[model samples]
Target: MSAIFNFQSLLIVILLLTCSCAYIQSLAPSLLDRNKIGLLGIFWKCAGIGE
Candidate 1:
């Protein structure tokens, strides 16, 4: 009984991780663009490149 319960818990954790990863993966493109803009903004400010 304990073993079965443990197995079910592990399965639930795995499923949750998989689903969350997929959701994040779908957002990867937008996230990357946002990060790129953020980095560029930082560089422009630090180096006065944009000004």
Candidate 2:
């Protein structure tokens, strides 16, 4: 039961992320362009979500 629930939850997350990325990319493409920050800026990257 736990395994099945986990699989279903993961699938839902995958679908949501797919839709979110597509919508975000089309709406404001600049928001996703954080690669320039490099590995050291991962903390700040996550903080951006709050904004």
Identify the candidate with maximal lDDT.
2
How far off is residue 22 in model 2, in Å?
Answer: 1.2
TM, every model:
0.45, 0.51
Off by over 4 Å in 1: 1-5, 29-51
Q: What lDDT does candidate 1 reach at residue 39?
A: 44
Model 2 agreement with the true structure over 1-51: per-residue lDDT tens digits: 453479887777656656666566567756666543877344334434434
**What is each predicted model's overall lDDT from 0 to 1?**
0.47, 0.56
Among these predicted structures, which one has the highest TM-score?
2
- Quick one: RMSD of model 2? 7.8
RMSD after CA superposition, every candidate:
14.2, 7.8
Report the lDDT tens digits of candidate 1 across residue range 1-51: 453479887777656655654455455535423443564444323222212
